[model samples]
Target: MEELDFFKSPDEFPPRRGGYGLVHVDCVGKRGYTNSALVNLYAKLGLHRYNWLEGTNFELDSIMKFNMRGAASPYYITLVACLPSSGLQQIFQVLVEEERLGILDLTCPISRPQGTESSKKESTPFLRPHSEPVSATHQDRLLGWTKSVIPWPSSEIGFSDTKRFYMLNESELQCDWISLYVELAICTSHRWFKARDLSNFELEIVQVAIESLHDKEPPSLKSKAAVIYIAYKDLAKARTGEPYHYQAVVRRVINEATGTLSIQGDCWIAAAATA
Candidate 1:
């Protein structure tokens, strides 16, 4: 069921950093950042290592700071997987598709190998090179996999506790998680939405936003939510760039709003009782 002619050139393909490319951001803290948030995010997704007497299965390979040069983006920590057997290719393929489909939350796209222009043009829908290695670009940093050897199953996250923004389809969705991923996508696209580049990710976010805006809640609440979402994103890029403290401050502001909501709920209840 494979397309042989599509794989034209008999020439050997160059080596790849074969494996799953699960991308995550490592928000550098005031001092040193920790990978705990990253590890916690993974663990929340029900991914853990099985340390058997015979051998280990499903382990963390590396967590490195990638070269993601974006305005509001934080340093990336790529979590590589050392599978039990050799399903690296399939895993990578699925991860790529999931990221594209917005099933998994990620800030960057999967990296392609170095290859010639002709071969790149002939690359499949999944961007797998047919002939030579796909050419590497600056965007490769977003894939979270570079050639590095590190110890597995690191605890303590990092020296400093890190914060991660991940969303897995299998888990219950978070309002903030959805907004965060959408805002990140908008930022990477330079805040411009082009239909040509719009796909499942774009469509999914738009659908959610629309539904949120049109929910049974009051119109004022919906408008306020949208305004807050936009304002937070704008503030993230204002002056300080993206820092842990900055995010913490923003989070406090958000929590204050949440607190206000609780007060409002009490007031509403009282008003109803009087009525």
Candidate 2:
């Protein structure tokens, strides 16, 4: 694949053959995202947490703003996902993985109407295991809403595409903003950073690690896996340093003989804006 330019429109992607593999729409304000912003987020999480296939391939189909019909015209964004059926399955499986990580309610409803009977109930149905009920308080605790404020997936039915773009109608399926940014981190290609762009400091680290592990850089280091980068953003949490934000695109190498996956690695400080 050619080097990805995250600054370009994310909507520019290949077409899906199967009818709207998995569509997700959410009402959102205009919060434009850049390629570097997503790269920063991905570096923080790493590929293991945000699996390239399970999380990043979901494409942004469209972002539409529609006026409320009756009330004063307040506009909101509708984000669409167009992935292959297998991709859709992978997304759900990732949700199951998150649940295994202890957030149980992947498909919880954000809120019900005031005075709804379900709102009066003490428990909310967890979706992954299907039909398992947990107390609302415990559910909130396990999901870390009070502590970390991580966005959990909550689904709703029915959305409108007033402009008729993509020939979409009222009956189609779509995931929402939480599914895009919070659940998946809205990614495209998996290559995070190119090692050729590494700063001298970062290159030195890679070279030393490689010499210690394999006595040389792997043949595929330049071509196959050059862009796997690392970035450090939250410095106040760090034990030492001046606490300035810094980022690097790193190359991680493994010597199967050593039985270690990251025995050798290198990084390049991003020459771009760190914020």
Candidate 3:
């Protein structure tokens, strides 16, 4: 089963920072329940401690948060057993095909083995060889596809020409809990969609612009929700690069859902280039 591959890396573990982990189940109906079941199963298999609270199993979260001091290494593998067995297999087959087709070229480097001469080599390349670069036309096509798929607030949904942009699939979007992953992708490509820093007045102006444009027909429910969340979070972060304040504003806006529907931030004005 496709889920078998997730469990195949017995030594692999999750990162210390908390993030979403994809889990496939034998059946669509079992997806939610299997999350808990697998936790118990793994714990019983001596994987780690398991706890169930209010019918929610947190085994995956615990394992991902596990820290090993000194010689101990935490195991952080996330497994999902998907159902309609054939359906799961088909999804994986498509993914593998995409990888082979160069449709998905996202890859990262792995550290060399410790205590090895190769590890000591200064000029050794860590990334996979034969990696291909996406052409500008391909990037434009991808961006256009993303714009078509995700309904923006309106034509007036102004994006900074200075910022970079990126397109993420549903799975990849979900895996990026903090949104840093997406930002990294954009920065790597040297494209910008949102500015990283702005004053409170600048943030207010952007929010007001968005609110002014929001009166039009809303996008699909998913798109609308995502856009709202993204606009607010990104705006807040742009004004203040700190997470705590951004999250506080997010929580406040979320709590005052009605008022939040309307923007009440600072205003924006053009700034001159500094010498």
Candidate 4:
């Protein structure tokens, strides 16, 4: 036989179309052995919490063994943006209820230090100048009301910055007048639905509540509710992409009756005015 070149033989390429070759053998082993083992392990562990996880695992297995050759992994990215506050609150409530029912373990630990600090702070008395004891007198009662109702270390909600406005009343107004206004504001916010909206419905509720307030008798003129002339105006302003504006009044209502409080007549803004 003549000398043949071993390198030139077609068999050197391992017969690309043959059965059970190295490439086929490796692929089959990965799919049947390694990939299957991983899938089985994952299934046994039950780690598929979300739909994305299960889908991702399936894609990964198919790609690794070249069974369904494509991308090496499923690149999935989800972006949730600008969730509404109301929806967020509902979700939080659901989670809390679930935890309460023992559907899920509590993820957060209770902090004893914070609890202790709060308790200690509560025990300390607030030292305000001329802090007279609260009494049946209008002044004392008003002071007492402010201290008890208003949260200490007040934020924007407290209207603490407007404490001067409250104090300025001392020159010309009585404590009952101030107290009644504060009480009305606080109670309406606490009792009514969508109180923050201050819409027509809220205004009606507030009016009714204020009318009810006038039924009570105060010891002095200073203690009476201020006669307020409420005027709702559209200054055409938007806060955080929401159409809102200065819903205002000409004066604060202190003492009033079922009949409307008269301001310079032009001061009152009713639905008719808005229309």
lDDT of 3 by residue, 1-275 (tens): 12222222323544435633433333223323322322222222221111100112222122221111111112223333223324331111101000111111121111111122222222343222222221222111122122224333343543332122223334433332223222322222332222222112122111211111122323322221123223323344444554311210110011111101111111111221111
Q: Which stretches of candidate 4 lie over 4 Å from their true place?
A: 1-124, 133-232, 237-275
Taken over the whole model, the C-alpha lDDT of each candidate is 0.24, 0.23, 0.22, 0.21
Looking at model 4, the pairs that clash are 174-222, 177-223, 225-254, 225-255, 226-253, 226-254, 226-255, 227-254, 228-253
Question: Residue 262: error of model 3 in Å?
Answer: 29
CA deviation > 4 Å runs, candidate 3: 1-4, 10-60, 64-76, 79-220, 223-229, 232-275
**Where's the lowest-lDDT run of ten residues in candidate 2?**
203-212
Task: Estimate the TM-score of every prediction.
Answer: 0.20, 0.21, 0.20, 0.17
Cα RMSDs of all predictions?
20.7, 22.2, 19.2, 29.1
* Tens digit per residue, CA lDDT, model 2, 1-275: 44422112334434446532222222244444222232222222222222221235444333332111111111112223345455442211111112221211122111111122321122332111222121222122122222123211122311122121121122221222212222221122222323222111111111101011121323221211122222334333234453433333222221112111121112222333332
Candidate 1 accuracy as lDDT: 0.24
Least well predicted 10-residue stretch by lDDT in candidate 1? 259-268
**TM-score of candidate 4 against the unseen true structure:** 0.17
Error of 4 at 180 (Å): 18
lDDT of 1 by residue, 1-275 (tens): 32222111222233346622323334233223433332223221211211111133444443323322223222222334455486441111011111222122232122211121222322233222123222222122123221121111123542121112111222323343343334333432233433222222321221121111123323222221211111122333234543211110011001111111100000001111234
